[model samples]
Target: MLSTLQPLLGLGVILGLAWLASERRRAVSLRLVLAGLALQIGLALLLLKLPFAQAVFLSMTDLVLAVQRATQAGTELVFGFLGGGAAPFETRYPQNSFVLAFQALPLILVMSALSALLFYWRVLPLLVHGFAWLLRRTMGTGGALGLGAAANVFVGMTEAPLLIRPYLAGLSRSALFALMTCGMATVAGTVMVLYAGILSDTVPNAMGHILTASLISAPAALMIAGVLVPEHPDAADRAIVAIPSTSRSSMDAITRGTLDAIPLWLNILAMLIVMVALVSLVNQMLGLLPTVAGEPLTAQRLLGWVMAPVAWLIGIPWSEAQVAGSLMGIKTILNELIAYLELAGTASAELSERSRLIMTYALCGFANLGSLGIMIGGLGAMAPERRDEIVALGLKSILAGTMATLSTGAVVALIL
Candidate 1:
């Protein structure tokens, strides 16, 4: 019974944390908060527990796999053996031959191009509108805020705001916070397949879980944002916004998408190199310190100590909390890509299946410092007059975003 009740405890704690961070505590709508939590729980049960929903998401994994294969085709043609092509020389350790930059990272390019093509064809807009409608009806979000939140599920944070570009200047503090929180709390579709590929060996139906995490986190984000910056009763905006496609044609969409992905691809590649090197350097410097429990005091260990309680609060078992916490810390401090890579590197024995599942949801967000800068820069460009306000709310959104993903983990823990 104690074990069964732990998740409920965690869920309450997660909600309480958001409540504590609320800017106007008295103004928070009990109805909206409860509705958002119910929606999150309901969606989790529908997507994760129902057999038909499971089958649908499982089927979607095949498309992810297909994209991987197609990406490999392009990579192989461009990079030859470096990109998973037939090598002239035999390697003593075949398992170590997979080059992440050449093989796995290319999936981002493929996914971006495919998403662009779908958007141009109006396929993605239909899905976005459906989700927007659901948010509008259930959460009482305005048209622009709901659409921006929904778009974040399919596109990057900066790109999501573009869908509601005209209304950025006029959005209320609460609505703007909701948009930023949703974007940071959820992962974009462009890198979803790449993440699935990385975790395929570790998590069952990896693509499905990643997709579901993003979907569920949307409501969680809005919920937390509403709490952090409660909308004034008289200030609510309920106008319905139209979804616009910027692509002129299918081919143009693909080309633009591919071009858009180049900078992101480079950014990811550079981040991996720099972050890994910096961590190694820090660890080497810390090696001079006295060992803790006969273990070297390194960055991961430090992070683990800091975030262990948070991991446990999300229903990760104590035994595995340190490792899980370290991943959470890496994700928050560095980025989710690094966190996922670290998770992939960890052995199964170190983290139980349940702990891994919880972490998958917990770590599936763009709430790191790097992304905060990107959000400010992108949104700032759109509304220069409100740049100061954007900056002020930016830091708080990180906390709100982190709480959003953690709340999803808590709900998953409750039902799993």
Candidate 2:
């Protein structure tokens, strides 16, 4: 049936597009691509299909939900009714009382602090090292690149590179591109909880999927980066890079982590306000244009038209591709936060359960224009000598990251 073949077609089309965009098409290693795909698919099956692994991830999701509840405790004390406290007056609609900024977003700060404390206690380093060991042994990546890739699964783009700071100066061109690409392709742990909170109403076990998406996307990013900029045989640097400890004490780690999260918290708050208002203004302006098929043309319609084919290629049914495409467009143009927020809203009601799951994997990354700027600014500071090179590769990283996530969606579609 066409439905059964759609995932295969989607996977082929995605890889073919990446090949067409390759800077060195002849240098692309088919073996590396297959290995990466195998790893991604294997992980998805182990974690999502196996009963024991499913139970483990489900337990992790419960822990994440517990963290959200814990965060609400702090928000309630600080923001009262606006922060999920008892309402002074009973309202007709109980669900409508949820305030995203005060109730859900605060989870980022709590998770940030906990992650830092765990890192300080050397808990996270062990896990990062375990994952890095797998990457190095399987993918033959250098110590620095492997560690950086693993770290990106749990930290921000700039923060992940800091794990391999000593080697950043000496990295080969291909390794550098791989590092940047992985960063853009993975979401930080700090915001993963927040994203899960946003989609909890729509997606079951959202935290587990967000975590799995980032874990699988790392290899996909490396794979795509290899296609786009194939590594020279002599370019591999296998130096053993150890994870550095930056915190002085547990208390210090929490303080530094909370302080670091403030800027990100403020930035997200500002971006949502400005982006939503601007989108509304744009839609209003577009309302003046002539209707298309008896419907007014708006920004979402335009984006949906442009990206619907891509959505369909990722195995979303045509009946729902337009809405899924619109969410994809919003994620790329704005940020993943906005896209997840939209998915959590009434727009989600229009999508089938399968389409929603595919979109969840697709939109789970930091490949937007805003993140591109952040990566450039952060990576530029760390390796000023490679500033020009980083700037040049910035846009390519976004493309690589986007394709990496799309590849993940394709794989999920095939399995599901």
- Least well predicted 10-residue stretch by lDDT in candidate 1: 234-243
> Candidate 2 lDDT (Cα, whole model)?
0.79
Question: Over 4 Å off in model 1, which ranges?
Answer: 54-136, 238-303
Residue by residue across 47-83, what tens digits does model 1's lDDT show?
9987688567556556555666788899999999999
Q: Which residue pairs clash within candidate 1?
A: none
TM-score of each: 0.74, 0.74
lDDT of 2 by residue, 185-223 (tens): 998776787899899989998988888888889889999
Model 1 scores a TM of 0.74
